[model samples]
Every structure is written in C-alpha cells, then in structure tokens.
Target: MKSSTRSLGARNAVLAVVLAIAGLAAQPAAAEERAKDLFGAEKLPTATAPQSFGFYSKGCFAGGVAIPMDGPTWQVMRPSRNRRWGHPAMIATIEQLSRDAAADGWPGLLIGDIAQPRGGPMLTGHASHQIGLDADIWLTPMPDRTMTRAQRETMSATLMVDEKTHLVKDALWTPRHTALLKRAASYPQVERILVNPGIKKKLCDTVKGDRTWLRKIRPFWGHDYHFHMRIGCQPGSPTCKAQEATPDDDGCGKPLAWWFTQEPWRPNKNPDAPKARDVMTMANLPKECRAVLDAPGPASAEAATYHGGAVPVAVAAPEPEAPSLPATTASGTAGLPSAVNAFTATPEVGVPVPRPRPPAK
Candidate 1:
C-alpha cells in the first residue's frame, strides 16, 4: 500500500509540471500574435510610409504614445485605387479654412496640389506619418513652375507665395505667406509644424517664441523647398504617441542643415491683419461677406473685394406671378366683350419670361 501511494503522488507532480510548461510556452505566442494584429507585418505594395516622423505624448491633437505596429507579424493588405481621403477632423479643419478664404474673396487654398499625403503599409514598414492627418506644404516661391495660373493665384491668395528669386524662396517667413501659418497655429489638432531654416526664423521673429501660440510649431530639415505639417493622430489609433511639448534632439529622423538661411525676414507692418481682408470669424464677419460664399459662384460687387467700388447686390427677390383671373370672372369678362379696353388692356403672357436661364451653351 505505501509503494502504490508513492507512485500515484509522483505521477500527479509530473502532470502539474507539464501543465505549467505549456502555459509558459503559450504566453509569448499569444503576445506576438496580438502585436501582429495591431501593426501589419508587411509593407503595402503601393503605399509609401509616412515622412517627417515625430510623435508627442501631450497637448491638443495628439493624445499620447502610439502603440507600435509589429512589422514582423502584421501583413499589409493592398489599398484600393480610389480617391485619397483624409481624416475627418483634418478635413473639417481644411474645409473651414477654404470656406473662409472663399468668403473673403481670397480664392481657395491649394492643399492637395503640392501637399504630401501620409503613406501606408503597401510601400514598406509604415512610419509615424502614415496616419492620413499629416501634410507638407512647399515653402518655395510661386514661380510659373508647372502649376496653372489659376492654381498659383489660388495658392497665393491664402498666404502661400511662390516667387522666382535667385535665392531659394522660403514660404514661412514671407509676409505674403503669413496668413496660412498664423491660421494653422490656431488649430488645436496640430501638434508640431516642421519647417525649413528660413521658416523657423520667420516664425520665431513673427511670434517671438512667446511661442504661446506657436508652442506646437517645431523646426526640422527640408528648408530648401517644402515645410512639413504634422497632423495629430485621431482618437482610437494605437500607433499614436505624443512627444514632449518642447522640441528635442531625439531621432526625429531628419537631414542635417539642409535649409539655407537662419535669418528671419522683416516683420510685416500688418502682422495682426485678420485671416482674409474681408471675413473675420462668423461672429465678427461683415454681414455682406457672410452671405457671399452661399451666393453660388463668386459674388458680383459685395462679394468681389477686388473691385474697388462694386456694391453688394441686394439679395434678389423671387419674381411675382401674373395675376390669375377666377374662371367665373374670365367667363363674365369674355361675355361682356366691351369690358376690355384695347389701349389699356395687356396681352396674356404664356409663361413668366424664364429669367433668361443665366446664359448657357
């Protein structure tokens, strides 16, 4: 009986050890699988990874540290060839700016024309900029380049200037380009704005690092031509990690001294000018400008600020209908015959002159 009891006890201990080993082995596999699901393993074939990769942990747009995507296990799926769409919050902000521009008769902002879209897995391991909210606006002057005249006019009107200077033109410091920069500074979703050398100088001088408003703007490489705008990660994304509010020298993954100048341009006398010449925020905006964007196409006089003396066209009233006679009255009048006066009576108009249908082909 003692020998049998010993054998049973030893068998139970062996089984317990085997179960513990199995549990330990299963843990890592489960963790790795979860990581793979979070970050896709492979690069998306057609998509490029995001550029100017930096992150923040606190502040407006970015909530905090982003969970990393595991490239080793997470496989990327090919995205469709449909039109590129941006994050809803980012789009909403851009649209507000555009509407404001149109209302002020400043034309529209050329966002996508020269803007860089965030890349995705198809290209390779996705980088920090992969989230759709980021964009890069070129800092170069608005020369003829390849853009159409209308495009140049539109971009320039929104404080984006492109001139052909012997020296490399910096967009951020130019007085003409201040509107967009200032407006961007006002948006809460923007965590950091990386610009070329000249742009940093301009921003520092313009706002004087009392950077109270410019707190989110940071300096980085690519000074020769374009300025990078980093959009904060939207809610629910795992990869977002916000960096410290102040700038740091950590691996921002940037080029060295690529920009040309450290000097700032002279400050414009009108640093405090409203976003557009005409419209302020809806509350302060002139009543006439408020109605301009809704008027379909551009406004005539009140809408077009360029025309010096043009007055706002009064909102046109709906045309009145020709007086319709009751059937009884019509019969009586016809029977009387003499009731009509040839000289004083008007001819029956078939249809109210169709307001000329505003000229068409």
Candidate 2:
C-alpha cells in the first residue's frame, strides 16, 4: 500500500508540470507582438484629455484631433492615409501657420502627414512623427482651385534639390519660399524646421538682415520636397520629452558644408537589418502606452476634428516680438471673394457647420 501511494504522488507531480508549461504556451507573449502593428491598427483618437507620453520616436498620445481635409488656408494631402490627426495645440499651430504663411505671400499650403489617429510608430515612413508634434508642409504651393480627393492622393510634390550637386534648383527657389520659412521660424512654439541640406545652404548664402531665425532651420536628409515643422511639448503633458535646443548662432558654417561631402551619403552597411519600429514591442514603450492603446476612441473622426477658436493659448509658448519681413503681394484667403472662399463656405465633410447665433438679448 505504501509503494502504490508513492507511485500515485509522482504521477500527480508530473501532471502539474505539464499543465504549467501548457498555460504559458496558451498566453500570447507581449515581447513577440510588434508595436507598429498594434498602433498602426488604431483608427481613431481616444476621447480622453490630451496627453503625450514618451519620446517622439518611441511613444504614444491620447486626445488627438484631426485637421479638416479642407481649410480656408490649407488643404490636407494624402487624405487616404488618415494621418491628419494631432494634439489640439498642434492642429491649431498648423492652422495658424497656414494663415500666417498666406499673409506672407505664398499660396495656400499643401499639407502632408501630421500623425496617425493615435500617435505611435506607423506601419511605414517617418521615425519621429509618433507624438503628434511633427508636420510636413509641401514645397509646392496650393493651386488656385480646390483639388479633388482623387487629385490630392495622386499629386506629386515638386522636388527642390538637385541630387547630383546637392544644391537647390535655382529656377524653383523664390523669395516667397524664403518668406514662408521665415514665417514658420518666427513662431516661438516652433523649435525646429527641418529641410534638405541644399535648402539650408541656399538660406545661409542668401538671407540678409535678421539671420537669427535661421538658427532653427536644421539640415536633414529627404526634405527636398517638403520642410518638416516640429513644435515643443505643450503645457499639460509632463511626460512629453523635450528635444535639445539648437545652437544660438546661425548654422551657416562648417556644419552646413558637411552635407556636400560623400561620407554623409554613403550607403547603409547593414541594409538588411530591421528598423527599430519593426522590432519594438509594447514592453519597449512607456508603461502609460498600454493604457493609451486600450483607451476608448471618439465615435467618428469628425467628432474629434478641430474647427478653430477653441484651442487653448497656453498650448503655445509666448510669441516673441515679430520679425521684420519684406512686404509682398496680398494673395491668401483674406483677399479671396466670399463666394469662392473655403473659410466662409461649408466643407463637404468632417467639419460641423456653425449654428446661427441667437439674437442678442
């Protein structure tokens, strides 16, 4: 009887070990799940209060708002990408820049990618637009007429840099282009404006008088067709990481010349290696990111869209005294007739029309 009891006890212990192994196998491992796939699948922003958690390349955000496909001074390109979303402050800044850029004599803005619905690593393109503060504005001016949705998707942006010489194509460069960059850099909230190295060289050689703002224009790869505008972290998000400040002097010196050399252009040594986005799992992101991913989203994309005037002023840093710029021809929405002006007319979708005001008591 003692021998039989000992044999039964050993069999039970073996069964327990087998069950433990099976349980672990049944559960999905967080390490095996790629963050890009999880974040890329999100289609809408959380309805919670806006907060950015983590670095621009390795974080996520909540309470995102989408810029309308068509605005008075701007039209969002690549509408199908569903990337027009950003923090309320970021959306407001873009709208404000559009108005300011128009006043500075450039045509309407052809807006590029802002961020995915919930800012996180994307399925493709960009390493830093993950936190809803980075935006890409095309070099090509908005055409005179409103573009069709199909056209916006198919349109090609004009390349401003010559690949062989690494220089701005002289014919395409204009004073208005310079004015647009100046207008963007003038805003205090704008921390950095990234452009092609060639474009940086062009600005360094030509800009006169107030060269102070040129300090913010950074030289980077692949900005030949568009310039990237990046704003600093805003008021409520304590978790948002701030980038290092640019040097005080105008960057027209040896740093700008380095891009002309062959070393910077050398091909990647490990082309087959995986990108950080490809391998990043939920474990790699901030602890808050999991909660952000699980949070509830708005009913529709339109429900969370920014329609102007409600943005908190605190989101932006105080504006510095305005810089002096050359006077240019008046051509933005301000001059457009009310009948044709998009600002006055109702947008086709995603933006609610304003209700008639009650008569004053």
Model 2 residue runs over 4 Å out of place are 1-31, 311-361
CA lDDT, every model vs. true structure = 0.33, 0.80
Model 2 scores worst on lDDT over the 10 consecutive residues at 336-345
Flag regions of model 1 displaced more than 4 Å.
Answer: 1-83, 101-106, 112-128, 139-173, 208-211, 247-361
Per-residue lDDT over 1-361 for candidate 2, one digit per residue giving the tens place of the 0 to 100 score:
9999999999999999999998788667733788888888988876555667788898888768888899889999999888998877688788888999998888889999999988888889988888888999999999988999999999999999999998999999999999999998887778899999999999999999999999999999999999999988765566788887788889999998899899889999999999989888888887778877776665577667778865221121133332211111123222212122112213333222223223345
C-alpha RMSD between model 1 and the true structure: 24.3
Candidate 1 lDDT over 1-361, as tens digits, reads 9999999999999999999999999886554432112112211111111111113211011100111111111111111211122333444444454444344333334442111122221122223333345544443332323454344334432232232221324433455455555566555666566654445545555554334555555655333344455555543333344444444332122322333333334356798774321221223222222222121221111221111111111222233322211112223432212121111112342101111112223
